[model samples]
Target chain A: MTNPTAAMLVIGDEILSGRTRDANMHHLAGELTKQGVDLKEVRVVSDEADAIVAAVKALSDAYDHVFTSGGIGPTHDDITADCIARAFGVGIDVRDDARALLERHYESTGLELNPARLRMARIPDGARLIDNPVSTAPGFTLGNVHVMAGVPLVFQAMVASVVPTLTGGAPLLSQTLRVNRGEGDIAAVLSQLAADFADLSIGCYPFQVNGAFGANVVVRGTDGGRIDAAVTRLAGELGL
Target chain B: MTNPTAAMLVIGDEILSGRTRDANMHHLAGELTKQGVDLKEVRVVSDEADAIVAAVKALSDAYDHVFTSGGIGPTHDDITADCIARAFGVGIDVRDDARALLERHYESTGLELNPARLRMARIPDGARLIDNPVSTAPGFTLGNVHVMAGVPLVFQAMVASVVPTLTGGAPLLSQTLRVNRGEGDIAAVLSQLAADFADLSIGCYPFQVNGAFGANVVVRGTDGGRIDAAVTRLAGELGL
Candidate 1:
């Protein structure tokens, strides 16, 4: 049986403005794929409460898991925690557990946990904190919606901490074969072969080689033997 | 005056699965930014029709313009055109204008425009074609939704054709100062300065430098004078 699917909601105005090139989507995609949890969708929204609430509710219902990144920072724009709380129809406040974590960090760092900073401690009720080794601000998992940080280092660390604890399906396996041919040149034959291998997903990624275009044929599947066989057949047919 | 805000809807399963790293979002963001339009959100949904319809409707109503990439292809999975039509409560069929373009291309290339290929010609009623110079398949603009090809080359060409036709506002001006400072060391000052520049957006992008984290600070604003002032103040504050 195929593993359960997941989605990602990247919330930030900075991302859309091209002020921030997102690293969270790429990280989550690679991580989820490794865990056999197929990332089925990804949405990047602004810091608006309505947008965040709408996307969170919609995606959480569609996929088995929904991991959100950004807008959970200490700044005034950080409204993801509150928006998520509302989406889940739950009340949120500064939790003792989260506040303690922030308090300890500020004490050690000798930095005051100001009102803006304290905003990070307001997690939705019933949500469990995901450990953040990079920073004291804790990420929380509310049902299937995993709320995380926007900063790449902190987000990656939090993801690493949370992913290991969840149940994973069969790991996804992939192999890439570089074909010094264009997609149009190999489409017909490759399409037929792709149809034959029903279980495996074959994707042709085109890249420029010299002045011409070439394709890197990638075969992905849970079954190692099937993937190997498909690669072999592909290489043989392409005369590589 | 600010250019109206826009959002991108990337309709593809390939992106979510990490089979394809999305080029559309980057391309659209840069293009819109240059045209003085602020891209506010981006959503990457699967090929599922329902998901596509929901995303299209929601995004169209929210933004001044909605740009959709992917799903307009000559394959079974290419369902973007139909979905957009459905979302608009419109009917989709093979339009004469689209068929003419495809017919011309087929005649020139001496390739049969098969039924599968003709699927590319099917477009929503009352839609204007967004020409594809690189490929024969034409994208179309209906209402506020500009449905474009998923292929990067085709998508870029379509965007080039569409951007010049749209009205725009004041373009965002930005300047970057590459620094060899760690974010942690500069956090307090940077945070304070960022708070001061309400109209300007300051983003700290960290990179690994000699096994240490170093960041390049970027300041963005619609007013060139404000951006320069912010940068000057930031430099003075950071003692750079």
Candidate 2:
């Protein structure tokens, strides 16, 4: 069976403004790769409600699962929850379970459960909460879309909580050989090898390191044996 | 007048596979911000021809300009040039000017200009070359899409060559106030300030520093005076 496909939507004005370099996309990509889910596409959009709603609708329809990060805090700009609610055409308000969780967490710290903080407890209709072990403010899974925080640590914690619930295919296996030659010098043989191993994917990533040009030829496939055999042949051909 | 809107398409399996963290997007975002180009959206797709072509067409049609990075090298996997041609329904081949530049660069280094290396010389029909000062392989501009190298240095160089030729609006100005309090504590006043400065975009980015939660409230607009006024008002209300 084909691996389940996934897409990521990153929403933040900080990322779009170049004020923050996004770390969540890279983290999610790696985690999904390990889970045997193919991350086919990733889109970064501003924190505007229209943009978020449009992206959420598109990604939800196109992929088996959609993971979103950012715009889920207790600030004026944190409108992701509302946009998501609108996208699904669902009624949203501060749910009791979520509010109780937040209330309990803040009570221990002697902080008031004010209206602004209560904004985090807003959940779309019929959605289940995704646990946040780092902080009591929980992320939620609405349909196939899993919405999480913009903060890297909290995002990772939520991912850990959500990953175990999803079904996954066989882990993708990869082997790499660093060839001490430019990609041009290695392209012909690499092409032939790729043609020979039709089921495997051969990717050549060239780099200029310490003024020396070379490439890392990576072979990836679900079948470990096939990937190993292909990598061996590739290494022998390149004389690496 | 509205600022020229742009979208970026980053193509590479390395990025999607979590083998590489993308640097070009952040660099381009900052440069475009300084040049007053509104970067509205960014998409990262794997190194597949169909994916690249579809994204290229979509972004190019939607935005004033489209900037693409990666998949332009001389490897078997480098299919960006051919994909761009297909996306625009134009023919592609090794142009004489691009080939001449490559030939001269290789000659100086005593490297043979093989077929694999010559792949870099391929340019789409009716395209103008974007200069690559760091590397001799030229990036090309076809229609509103500017294709650049994946390597950060070369990509930055190409951007420098292209940005000066494009028409830029007034540079976007931003002023920020750091409030040493939780977003919940600051949200009410922040919302009021945002409403007062409806023409300017106001964003609050929450952060945790030294175990204390706070936020950076930023006001951005083309009108420097308006942005400054909004920031001043925000700071006064926040008592910062």
Candidate 3:
């Protein structure tokens, strides 16, 4: 069976403004690959409603799963929950289950659930809440879209909670052969190898270290035997 | 005048497949911010032709400038040039200028300019070449889309070459105040400060250190005086 396809929507002005470097995309990409889901595309947009709404809707429609990080905090810039609601045409309000989660956490911490903190309980209609072990604010899953936090720890916890529930295909297998040669030197043979291994994905990643050029040829596919075979053929052809 | 808007397209499956962490995006983001250009959106797509073409066309039409990284090598997966040509409906060929640059570099390095290496000279019709100081192969600009290499060193050098030619607006200025307070505690006052200083972008980033919650409030705008005033008011309101 074909692997489930996914897309990521990273919403934050700080990331776009270059005030912060995003760690969530790389984390999610690695996790999704391990879960046997094909992450097709990733879009990072600023904290604007129109851009967020359009991106959410487009990605949600195009892929099997849509994972979003950022803009879910209690600050005024936190507009992701509202955008998701608008995109799905659902009315959002402070749901009892989510409110209780926040209430218990705050009560234990000797903190009051102020109006701003209460914003974390706002969930769209008919959505399942994703657990956040790192923080109290709960992310919700409405349809195929998963709304998670921007914080790396919280986002990763939320992803760990969500991926197990998803049906995954065969795990992608890959083998890499790092050759001490320039891409131009290996291009001809690599292209022939790629054509021969039509079902596999043959990728050439070139690198330069200490003024010497080299390339790492990676062979990836679902079948372990095919990847192994491709790597062997590649090594023999390159005389490595 | 408002800042020129830009979008970045990061190509290559290594990034999407979680095999490599992308450093080029962060470098570009910081550089663009310094150049007084607003990087509004970023899309990470694989080396697929249709996906690359679609992203190039969409970003080029929506923003003032589009910067693309990856898939410009001689390998079969390096299809960015072909995709860019298709996106603009232009023919591509080994232009004389680019080929001559490669020939001279190869001659000096004592490397054969084989057919595979010669593929790097392909340039779309009417496109101007962006010099790559790190490598002999040059990046090119077709309309507003700049096709750069996947290698971080080469990509950065190409950006440095291209950015100086474009007109820049006022440099974005920002100030930050780190407070030992949770987001919930500052959300109310921060919201008011944001409203009062509508011209500035007031951002609150929360962090948890050693089980204690704290936040860094950043005030950003083109006007220095306005940002300072907003920061002063915010600090006073927060009692910090």
The alpha-carbon deviation from the true structure for residue B236 of candidate 1, after best TM-score superposition, in angstroms, is: 7.2
| DockQ (Cα-based) for each candidate | 0.35, 0.80, 0.87
Model 1 scores a TM of: 0.82
Local error of candidate 1 at residue A70 (angstroms): 1.6
Q: Which candidate has the highest DockQ of all?
A: 3
> For candidate 1, lDDT tens digit of each residue in A183-223?
55666666787799988877665555454657677788899
Candidate 2 C-alpha lDDT tens digits along A29-82 = 889889998889999999889999999999999999999998888878899989
* Top candidate by lDDT: 3
Q: How well does candidate 2 score on lDDT at residue B93?
A: 99
* Rank by TM-score (best first): 3, 2, 1
TM per prediction: 0.82, 0.98, 0.99
lDDT of 3 by residue, B51-95 (tens): 999999999999999999999998888999999999999999999
Per-residue lDDT value at A90 in model 1: 98
Per-residue lDDT, model 1, residue A171, is 82
Q: Locate the minimum summed-lDDT window of 10 residues in model 1 chain B.
A: B204-213
Q: Which has the better DockQ: candidate 1, or candidate 2? A: 2
> How does chain B of model 2 score on TM-score?
0.98
